[model samples]
Target: MRRNILPGLLIVLVAVIGNRLSPNFLDFAYLRDSATLVAELGLIAVGMNFIITSGNIDLSVGSNMVLTACITAKFMVGGMPAPLALLLGVGIGTLLGWLNGVLITYFRAPSFLITVATMAMYRGAAKALLGPQSVKAPSGIVGIDTQTFAGLTIPLLILLVTASIGAFVMQKTIFGSWVVAVGSNSRTALYSGVPVARVVRTSYTLTGFICGIAAMLMLSRLGLARHDLAMGSELDIITIVVVGGTAIQGGAANVIGSLLAFILIALLRSVMGVANFTAEYQMTIIGILLIGMVLANRLPLKLILQKLRPKSQRAP
Candidate 1:
């Protein structure tokens, strides 16, 4: 419990620092509006958490989002009904994810290398679909993120529901056990008949399916599709998962913590925005945070504990 609470405390500390940078950081409207816009990235972060917890990474998610959105846009432009067009986008995203799983498992390829290649492939395909220009989505289509219900915006509600189900699956099910076991030790999991391949495949596919949904939400919210949509988002998504206290080497995840991390990062970026920082500088700051989190794990626990202990208790 103390371990999980560490991240929560860090969130409070970051918020305090943000408020120091900009008084508007504490504004209710700023926070609420930020929460609504963050659901897109937050959704990807949730799925990436699942994949990372299962001992793999999907670098192609940004590309996956763009490709799905492009497909939906093409479908809509072709006179298809909006609902079916959106569903196809999700289905294609799942297939793309399944492709990643298949190649990694069957070919015994390095996950990092395979995903990197497909990341380009997927993004290129999206550009190919539109020939290097953005496509406007059907104007009559109402966005799920546009309205709030009972004091909660629809996109936020969707994210909460998604996270709740994900939390249950990750924390309460046999499959969750398999995922942790596989991540912690693949060979042992395979030897124990846990079907490591299936677990991994399921994780990647779930990521793709969620990205598909994210594509739908983004498409509706922006009313357009472009090959560049969500470009470079994979890094941001990974940053959220790692800073939330999930082990990069696998075996653990904190869903609620990731949500808080998303909010923390969002607030931090917004703070920088208010201070007139350029996007490049802001991303550099976040990149530093990501690296720090990864390196923090290398420190010995005794040293960390000693640093946390009172100086009076230290040896002379």
Candidate 2:
């Protein structure tokens, strides 16, 4: 609990100070918009958390999002029902994810190299599928943007539900335990009879499913889908996952921590927007934050704090 509590407090502190530093950020609209942005990114970050915790990474998430969106646009343009289009998008994403899993598991390839290659392949395929033009979703499907319940945007609600389910799966279930075990030491887990390959494959498949969901939300927000949708977004997703305290080397991950990190990054973006900072500055800040968080995770700060406390007050 301390692990979760500390990072959460730090995130809140950053948000409060950031708002104070930028007067334009104190408004309700800014906060709502920021929340929506975080939710969108959080959807994928949660899935990435699972993949990373399983001792793997998926660089094709951004491309998956684009491909899903392109497929969704094509369906919608063909006058298909919204529900059908949505399902097709998710199906396409799941297949892509399964392909990744099969390639990595069967060929004994590094996940990093495999996903990097798929990332390019998926993006190129999306561009070819959608051609050089963009497709706009019908006004009815786009109307989801204006729909809300309980003071939350529909998209935000979807994000909340996805995060909640992800947190449950990663923290409370047998599968979650298996994920940590496999990630911490695959050979040991295998000796203990855990299905390492199955876990790893499922992680990638789930990641693709999440990417599909994110594509729908993005399509709603933009009211249009293009081959370039979510381009280079994999970097942002990876940054949030690391910033949230997920170990880059695999072993342990914090779902709530990743959620807080998602919020922090979104707040940073909102602040940048209000301050009119260049995109370069935003990227630089994210890069610095990622490096700092990774370094901090490697430190024995807790042990140092224990040492600094008064001997009389310390636990025996």
Which candidate comes out best when scored by lDDT? 1
Clash tally, candidates in order: 0, 0
* Every model's TM-score: 0.93, 0.93
Q: What is the lDDT of residue 70 in candidate 1?
A: 90
Give Cα-based local distance difference scores for all models.
0.84, 0.83
lDDT of 2 by residue, 1-316 (tens): 5555645776677677777877666676667766776465788999999889888999999898888898888889998998889888888888888889889988978999999999999999989897889999888767565577898778777877887888899889989989999889989999999988888888888888888888888888888888876766777788888878788888897887777777777777787777788877887877787777778878998788889999997767
- Candidate 1: the clashing residue pairs are none
Off by over 4 Å in 1: 306-316
Q: Where does candidate 2 stray beyond 4 Å?
A: 311-316
Model 2 residue 177 distance off true place after TM-score fit, in angstroms: 1.0
Query: lDDT, candidate 2, residue 37?
Result: 60
The digit string of per-residue lDDT tens for model 1 on 1-316 reads 5445656776788778878887668987677667777677888888888889888899999999989999888889999998789889899889898899888888877788999999999999998889878898998775667687877778878888888788788899999889888889999999999998888888889989998988888888889999977767887889888887778988888777787787777777777777788978877888888898788756686777788889999756
What C-alpha lDDT, on a 0 to 100 scale, does residue 224 get in candidate 1? Answer: 92
